[model samples]
Target chain A: MVSITSSRLVRGREARRAAPALERPGVAWAIPGLVFFILFAIVPMAGVVYLSLTRWDGLSTPQFTGLHNWWRFFSDGQILQSTLVTAVLLVGNILVQAPISILLGVWSAGYQRNRAVLSTIFFFPLLLSTAATAVMWRQLLDPNFGIPPKLADLLGGNTDLLGGQKGAIACLIVVTSWQFIPFHTLIYQGAARAIPLTLYQAAAIDGAGRVRQFFHITLPQLRNSIITSTTFMVVGGLTAFDIVLLLTNGGPGTDTSILPFAMYQTAFRTYDYGYASVIASFLLLLATGASLLLVKISGYDKMTSTMEGL
Target chain B: MRRRRNVVAGFAAFAWLLVIGVPLYALVNTAIQPESKYTDGGPVSIPSAVTLDNFRTVIHSGFLHYVWNTVLVAALTVAIVLLLGVPISYAVVRGRGWMTRGVFRLFLLGLAVPSQAVIIPLFLLINRLGLYDSLWGIALPTAAFALPVSVLVLSGGMRDISASLYEAMALDGARPARILVNLVIPLSRSSIATTCVFTALQAWNGFLFPLIMTQSNDTKLVPLGLYNFVSQYGGNVPALLAAVLMSAVPILIVYLFARRALVMGLMGAGGK
Candidate 1:
C-alpha cells in the first residue's frame, strides 16, 4: 500500500510539472508581450529612479545631484502650492461630488425601467474626450458668450464664471463632477442591484420607509462599493489633467496648478527634469499610500471573494 | 397604491431624463450653431442657423491624421493587452504557487500606481528608447497601464470555470496549454471582448500619457489633436466644435453598440 500511494503522488507531481508547457498553442504569442513589458515598463521604471538623481537635459549626459532636487521641492513654493492644489481638488471632489452621485445612483436604480436610457445619457459625457468636454463646458461658461453668463444675466448680475479664482475653480469642480459622476453612478447602481431583494422585503415588513431602507439596508450593503468608488475618485481627482489643462491651464495667476501639471511644466516646459522627478516621486508616494489605505479599509479580501463569485 | 407608485416612478424617471437630456441637447445644439450667432444669442434659444461648415472646417484642419492615430493606438494597445494579460491571468488563476501570487501582487501594485504617478519616469524611458515622439510609445504604456484591469476582469471570468473542466481535460491527456486555447479562450470570449472594449475606450480617450509623451503632430491622438485646435483656432468656435464632434463620433458609436458589455466590464473590474 505504501509503495502504491508513493507512486500515485509522484505521478501527480509529474502531471503538475508538465501542465504549463504541455500544449498551449496560444501561449507563444504572450512571449512578445512579456518582453515588451519587461523592457518598456519594468526596466524604464528603474531608469526613472536612477535618472531622478541625475541632471539630464534630453540630450546631454546626466550628472548626479544627491537629493538636491528634493530639497528644492521643499523650498520651492510653487511645487508646494501645486501639491496643495491637487489636495484641494481631491477634498472638493469627494466632498461635493460623491454624495450627489450616491443619491442619483440610488434614485436611478430604484427606477429600473428607464435605466438603460437614463444611464446611457448620463454616460454620454464620458464618451467625449476631456478636451472636447473642456471645450464644450468652456464655451458654455464663456464669460462673454457662454451659458453661465446668460444665467447670470437673467439673475441680474454680471459674473465671469471662468475669470476669477472662485468662479474658475467652481466651474472646474462642476465640470469634473459632471464628467465623472456617471462612472460612480454605474458602480453604485451595480452594487445596489446586487443587494438581495429579500433584504428590502424584510425592511418593508419592519415598516421602514424608502429613505430609512436606504440608510439602514442600502448604505450598509454598499459599503464596499463606496470605498471602491471613493478610492477611484480620490486618485482621479488628485491627478486631474485634461480638464484643467484645456479650461484653465492653471491660469489667472497659477490658481489651478495641480501636481501632475506642475511636474510637467517643471520638467518639459522648463527643462528641470530633476526637480520634476522629485515632485513626481512625492506624488507617486502619496497616491500609492492612499491606494494602500483604500485596500486596507475596504477589505480587499472580501471584495475579491465577491468578484470571484461574480 | 400601485397606480400611485407608477406615477411617482414615472415622474422620477422624467426628472432623471431632464437632467441628463438637457446637457446633451445643449452640446449638440451649440456645436451645430453658426459662427456668426455664437455669442450674441441666448444660450437656451434655438440656433439661428445650423451648418455643416464647422464639420467641414474641422475635417480640413488636418485632424484626420489624429483620428487614424487614435484608432491605431487603441487597437494595438488592446491587442497587446490581450496577448499579455490573458496568459498571465490564466496562469495566476490556475496555478497555486508563490510565483503566481508574486506575479499577481506585481499587478496589484500596478493597480495602485496610476500612470500619472509614473509619467515622469515613463517620459525619460520613452526618450531613451527613441520612441518619445512616436505612436508606439503611447501604445506600449497604455497597454501596460491597462494590464491590471484586463487581468482582473479576465481572471475573474476564468475563475468561474469549474475545476472539473480542467480535470476532464487533464484526464483526456490535454495539457494546460491546449485547454487554455480550446476551452478557456472559447469560454471567456465575452469577457475578453468586454475587456477589449473598455481598454480601447480608455486608450483612445486617454489624455495624460499622450499629453506628456508625444510633442509633435505626427503621433498626436484625437484628444491631443483637439487641444491643438483650440490653440490654433480658439476664436473659431465652429471649427473647434467640429473637431470635438469628429473626435467623439467613433467612441460614441462604440458606446452605443456595446454599452452593456463595456459598462459591465468597468463595474466588474475598475468601477467596483
Candidate 2:
C-alpha cells in the first residue's frame, strides 16, 4: 500500500513535469488597464497637484502662482469653517453611527432568527442614489410642509430641522448617518459572523452570560472591521458632497458646507479652479493620512500571505 | 432568560423596521399621492387620493431620456470594466515576478484618490480629448475608477481556481487564450457578475463626473436630472418624489434579485 501511494505521487509529479511548456504570460496584459488608469486616475491626480500651484479658470491659460493658492487655503475663513464642519461630521460618525452599527451587527449575528429580514431592512438605504436620498430627506424636512417640523409642532417646539443654520449640520449628520449606517453594519455583520462558534460555546459552557461573552470575545474579534468601517466613514464624512449639495446647497448660509462642497463651489460655481485644487489636494492628503493610520492600526499588510495563493 | 432575550431581539428588529420603513413609506406614499394631497396633508400622512399623474408628468418632461442616458453610460462602463478587468486580473494572477505585482499596486492606488479631487483635471482632459459632454466621457472615468475593485475581486476569484486545473489544461496543450475563454471566464462568472453590478451601481449613481464633465441636456444623467428638477420645481414635492422613485426602481429590482452577491461582494471589498 505504501509503495502504491508513493508510485502514484511520483506519477503525478512526472505528469506535471512532462506537461507542454507555455511561456508564462507577461505584464503586457496589464498595459491596457494601466493606460486607462494613468490617463483617468493618475494623470488627473497629478494635475490637481500641478493646478494647485497655478492660477487657472476653466476658460483661460493657467499662470504659475508659486504657493499663493496654498497660502490662501490655509488662511481662508470659509475654508476653515468648512473644515470645522467636516471635523464635526467625522466626530458624529465615529460617535453615533459606529457604535449603533456595531450594536446592530452584533445583535443580528447573535440572534440569528430574522437576521436576513433585519439586514435587508437596514441595507435598503444603501441601494438608493445619494441624490435620491438627499431629495427624499429634503422634502421630508421641509419646514413648512415636512414631517420633522410637524412632529416638533405636535411636541410643542417650533424649529426648522434642515432650514436653520444651527440645526443644519446636525441634520446633515443625521441624514448622512442614516444613509451609511447600513454599509457599516454590513461590514460589522461580516466580521461578527466570522467569529468562531466554538469560542462562544466555550464561554457559554464556562457560565458566561451573553453580554459577557460578547464583551470578552466579539468586541475583540471585531476590532479590525470596526477600524476599517471607521476609516470609510471618516474619509466619507470629510469628503461628503452630493447629499450636502442637494439637501442644502451648503445652505442656511454655508453652515453645512463640508470640504468637498466648498471645493465644488470654488471650482464650478465661482470658477476658482486653482484654489479648488488646493482644497482638493488638502482633502486628498487628509483622506490618505486617515486611511493609512487606520490601516496601520488594523495591521493590514497590503501584500498579504493569502495573496501569494500558495 | 431566553424568552426575555427573544423579546429584546424582537423589539430591536421592530425598531429597525420603523426606522427604515417610515422613510421608504414616505417616498412611495408621497410619489403616489396627488400633488394637492401632498401639499395639504402632513408629510407622513397616508394619501386618500392616489394617482400616477406625478409620474406621468415626470415622464413627459424627459425623465425617461435621462434614465436612458444613465443606462447607456452604466452599460458601457460595465462593458469596458469587464473587457479590461478580466484579462488584466488573469494576467496578474498568472504572471510571474515583481512587474505584475507592481501593476496590481498601481491599480490599487486608484482607490485612494477620490473622484472629487481629480474632477477638475478630468474635466480638462475630457475637454482636451474632445469627449466632453458625451456619455463616453462619464463612462470612461467611471470605468477607470471601477477597475481596481473589479480586478481585486476578479483576481481573488481567479486565485480560487485550483493550480491542478491550470496544469491539466496546459498538459492538454491548451493555449493561454483558450484557457482564458474556457477555464477562466467560465469559473469567474460570479466575480464578473459582482463586478458588473458594482460598476453599474457606481455609474448609475455617479453625480460628480456627470455634473462636471457634461454640460448639454443630451448628456444629462438621472442624478443630474433629479437635481435640476428639484431646482426648477422646488414647490412640487410629489412630482419630485415621483421622479426619485422612478429613478430608484430599476436599481431596486436589480438589488432584489442579486442582494446576496451584491452584499457579499461589498462586504468582501470593505473587509479587504
Q: What is the overall TM-score of model 2 with all chains considered together?
A: 0.92
Among these predictions, the greatest TM-score belongs to: 2
The weakest ten consecutive residues by lDDT in model 2 chain B span B1-10
For candidate 2, give the lDDT.
0.83
- Highest DockQ model number: 2
Give the CAPRI rating of model 1: acceptable
**Worst lDDT window (10 residues) for model 1 chain A?**
A20-29
Give candidate 1 regions above 4 Å deviation.
A1-35, A153-158, A299-310, B1-19, B265-268
RMSD of 2: 5.6
TM-score of model 2 (first chain only): 0.87
